[model samples]
Target: MNEPEAGAAPEEASTGAASAPSGLSRRGLLGLAIGGGVAGLAVGAGAGLTGGVAIGRARAAEDAHSAYEFFGAHQAGITTPVQDHLHFASFDMMPRTDREDLISLLQDWSYAASRMVQGLEVSATGAVGGPAEAPPDDTGEALGLPAAGLTLTFGFGPGLFENEDGDRYGIAAQRPAGLERLPAFLGDDLDPQTSHGDLCIQACADDPQVAVHAIRNLSRIAFGRARLRWSQLGFGKTSRTTAAQATPRNLFGFKDGTANILADDTEALADHVWVSSNDEPAWLAGGSYLVARKIAMLIETWDRVRLSEQDNIIGRDKGEGAPLSGGDEFTAPVFDSTAIDANSHVSLAHPDQNDGIRILRRGYNYVDGNNALGRLDAGLFFLSYQRDPAQFISLQRRLSTDLMNEYIRHVGSGIWAVPAGAEPGSFVGEALFA
Candidate 1:
């Protein structure tokens, strides 16, 4: 659920006329390394998102492998068990590429994604078989590793439908009314370099290597059609989507998402998370909207605050994670209690305070080294999904005065209209192309 923004480049499909010989098997899996094993690439500037750690030819993407199906009514990651790691890449499409190029890229991307999610190589020819002197078809780093429950999701930003230059992909007419650019919010300190993207791919898996491998291969297949804009690697989920999973803590060390919407709540999903065919543009039937915010935490300052004040700002107990007014973690907070501050996080973000509106939060904890001042450069990479973008917008507007704002700043933001999953015979954005 955590993410970054990016653009792309691609590798041509293999001819299938060639197959790897014995001894070349696992080395072929190393073919999956991000940036195709290149260094100081993929993300730009401050992020330095390059580290193509090669997984030697001795390993294969098969050892403890377990896979999730690629074809479904809705994408898998949205409701799937929250994964351990996320490799999010955002991309800006190539200039004047036209609709055909976009379509072809989607076709190719879907093919590669479908195969990779199933623990198969991206190309029919695998990594070792290709033009002898040219680059290998597959990168090979993911070789010998289990599939690790990997899921890949695709999304289109407002720019993808119509950029400043007009509808470059000839997709302006099909843009859903709900896909507008997000409005600037209070306390926003967004960095343009890591902010929005024309498109995005979110890869999640239990294994970090498997997650990075997914994004790397897809970015490789996207060459010529797109370029990387920004990317983010996130760990330690800050939210839970199921009852079986224990509630996890954020950097603030509070049990987060204790009252979140569970994945199995079909009623709640239909009412708030998924978009139905009757909604708009018609093409987004089973899809949803994704909002990403890179919130930077002022941890040093937060740590300096008294423990009781910290709990007061959060509206929950430091150890129990219970609402300040009483009860257990999942117990409803007594919002009306005199002990509860009106501006506290839970008080302001509560569904009751927002007209029963709620968004599915899938945030992750991130630590990107240290800032120039040498303090922790980290915060919550906030990710949420809702049927209507306004649902999130309205709720956020209500939280504009939250007491937690003193310790966090929104440094990155993006909103993407997640297209529904590809059916067996189609690509991810097939409906839009139609």
Candidate 2:
């Protein structure tokens, strides 16, 4: 996708004498008046502001052709120990009158899924690494969504569809190594490339049965609302498993989301993830951004490596997100000699060099059991959010051939442009194309 021109405006004059109210020029004002008058006529005809807003929003929504939502979880403190868990879900939709219905279905599914997992001690955080800013309220409760014990994230693609294909969305769920996969209704014949929508859900509980039960129940609710096009099921190490025995740390068994920017730190958050837009409609000014990627991992092949090699490839210890160069989880990674050793971090391995690839990654590690060859079915439901996808793509492409590439694949991908929240009585996407 072509990078959008930076929305930055020219600097304003400093002196009072030079400063003047930059009102619309005569022609511009005339245009506004004419447009408003026409809009008034539409309103007078009973079309209402909703229609006007929807029309405007439709113009804007045209930019968000592809999108995705990602969710994941981990254990908190010393809670349950037998299983580690995570989950992901994604959907792609065609932009039509049905778009609203699809969004409603997802909203309902999210609400229902949260209810099913209520009381489970799972960790979740949304939009871990992406350019998009954090929602005004981190709790997500205002949107009628639950606060994940670990993390939950939403990303928007550059456009809803490619050449009139359709809008697309993605989901990632993390759970224990043996948790059940999403049902056939959600995963049957899913196409990584052409499939327009995707959804994933996963959970972990003390009992494998409980995890399966929660997942199956949530699947029914989601599938009941929207037709499933394609899907996959897998398992991975959970926070509950002993650190030494957990396989595929972060599901890729290498430090995942290593470059994820911190959300709580004001300066860092503003620089790495959030987008500020004074020109944007009032409803969207403080809102964050979103970026979604449908990344596929080659887990069966990755599992063949020795533990030490895996650590080198991922630049972190498999058991924890610690830097291979040494540090605790969440500590700033030291990209020094050891980390950049030709045999280790390699020139292409350092994430900082990959400009335009900036985001907060909040995703799930999944495993789908061994295949006929007995190889483990493992990969990442990779979801990332950023103020823009253009920036994130630069980083992802570098990783395409990085040592990690041998263990991962990018079979499917798309982009979406998400807008900020809507006012009361207004539906999402009403701002640009009512």
Candidate 3:
């Protein structure tokens, strides 16, 4: 995707500027229009309009852009409407950094993240305003972009509390009992390079570029304090968060998250998503646990299987995504029905079969081109949030018996303690330090 040249002017510019090139991207043109000064809008000679007026107009135009608030009781991305694109990255704190370094990093991240979520630059001296001798404060690719409903959710991995160095941050005593490296599962062919980290950020937006831009700039902001461990780009969201969103399909083409916990279900969220005040770690009261699994699908092999067999494995019809027990997508499955296999994916994952356990899923499909074997390296990057990590552990343990396991391999995995949203002047995870 090529960006518009900075010097070009949009067709709508009334400054009598020449038209932009035919190839000017829609995003580039919008940027020029919204930026106010980008297209060289010369104020009339007789009118004594100050540059501040121009900047104010630009700020007002920014109000029309789509955005989400960064400060709240809970992070925006977790239960916020699932976006179409994702740029999820994990990071490790730099060696020898102290608690002050960690605190400063969080503060800096929150400040920049707050601005970016509003369609503003990461800093007051953003993309082009910094001293010419210094690098730009922002990467500038999203210069003309709207927020595109961008959301950045941060989390702490077990390592952030205690690692080989042992209680490096002095917050080890506050670590949630359930916040640890997940145990090895039945079919996990785990890759060490992609799993685990001291910190993680889940960036999501409607536009792929917007999502990428958030992570890229934040990674830059972490220059000395932290380093990115691994990242994944995903599209075609595999789950829905609200009732209005239609169920989405995974790489297997089966509608996923049909029975997922919705954002508006307060009781369900309280019981299964948000951490209660009485929970062991008081600091994580309103937060949740995030579990990420990179499941690789054997596309060629699955495609070769008969349609009926595929449906049987999933316990739902591939076409309508209705249970084989004869109901619509949302109908409760009759697990005992002869048509539904007890070991089927749906049956094994349903709450009825697992003591009413549920997780809010916000996942996406990813295609990382091809593997060395010439086979497509494509699969589902599974993301789920729960009040307790044990919820996921037990569910996953039950899934070991899933018939669909034959076609999928869990290649990468991670778990993080997603802190509650930052207050107006505080950074995320401030409660722990306080």
Candidate 4:
């Protein structure tokens, strides 16, 4: 649910071997062992090197298409054009863990995430080059897959700062004043199991397996330090961060995010999305706040409504996604026009009505099979990044009166202070630890 510039030195799988271990990179060895035949067993010897060269060759080709740098001013996924799929996960630090445990966890995650984004495996040993007796550092699912425009964004939840036991990581004072659990909203039937966590990672990629692989391996890397609380898989991106991409649809079959803040809009981004240096908590400068809402759509009930009524509820023509007041999809809505309902979704969430507030949205549609009543348990996984949590709080409160409220329920919720991106050799959130 973010944006990042595309550029990473594609780590090519090596085609030759017989080099000193100190001189060769992990990928180089993996490339030689898997790309070339026998006699090139510099590492992981007798660990089965007959897997074939297709995977190595595939990695090279995939890198050429999508490989975003993991280090920047802000995390990539937020401004990086929203990918086709999402694998969002939340985690909790294990009890009895000290500050070092937390720091090391972030370090491990950053190291693995940086490599994965470059179309490389989680470690030098990777899936096939590890010792025969030990588990490989990376899961094999994504070995042959390209980066697929994958971007992994990490965030620290309120619990990470201070939980019931108090200041577990000794950084409670650094928590932003607005970083607490989101207050209950109207029509909220949130489930605690999926509501909050101590940490969260948003992995996005065009390929579902690649996205899943990232979370899977990162979770494995956590081991005793932290445990995953909950996760969600999503597809059919509900919003666009770049104008080059088309606005995608939610499960409700209407165009979404027609007027979302674009990555190139630096002025708007600074004003609405990224946290500033002058803001509180100097450690979080250049970072942003992420609010995740797992909204459940009443699919069966909405389907029974007449087509025109559906348009009225959303305040946009389902066909062209234009405001009912006229003009194309991108045209400003004429809220004064009688054609637009005062309580319509568009009218209530419009920036003009909300004191000029705007948020960068990166949402996705999810269908998690049928519920007990034989209805599709599908809806929108709403993800938005704003400079302040109050921005979302205000908007959600205003939406309580929207016409679309009858068709959706907020089922899962979480808020995390997404720190600025890591520098080339540093882990994400390093400033916070410092």
TM-score of each: 0.87, 0.50, 0.85, 0.87
Give each model's whole-structure lDDT: 0.74, 0.35, 0.77, 0.77
The C-alpha local distance difference test score for the whole of candidate 1 amounts to 0.74
Query: How close to the true structure is residue 223 of candidate 4, measured as C-alpha lDDT?
Result: 69
lDDT of 2 by residue, 1-434 (tens): 11111111111111111111222233222222232211111011122222322432343332212111111121111111222233333444334424444455434433333333342211122213222553210112212222222212222223332225433221111111111222222112334542334333324322222333334333333332333333332233322212222322455545443344433334543454444564333323333444333445666666678888877775566687576566675455555555734434323534445553445443445444454777554455444444544455455444444666555544444333334433323333333333
Q: Count the backbone clashes (under 3 Å) in each candidate.
A: 35, 88, 1, 8
Candidate 4 residue spans exceeding 4 A from truth: 1-64
User: In model 2, where is the ten-residue run with the lowest total lDDT?
Assistant: 1-10
What overall lDDT, based on C-alpha atoms, would model 2 receive against the true structure?
A: 0.35
lDDT score, candidate 2, position 39: 12
lDDT of 2 at 314: 58
Q: Residue 168 of model 4: what lDDT?
A: 73
Clashing pairs in 3: 31-144
**Tens-digit per-residue lDDT, 1-434, candidate 4:** 12111111111222222111122333323432443221111122111112212322344454434767787778889888777777889988889988988887787778777888877887777888878875566668887777777889999999999888888788988999989899999899999988899999999877766777788877777766677788887777888877788888777788898888877788888888888999989999989999999999999999999999999988999989899999898878888889999999999998888888888888988777777898887888899988999988989898888898898989999999999988867788999989
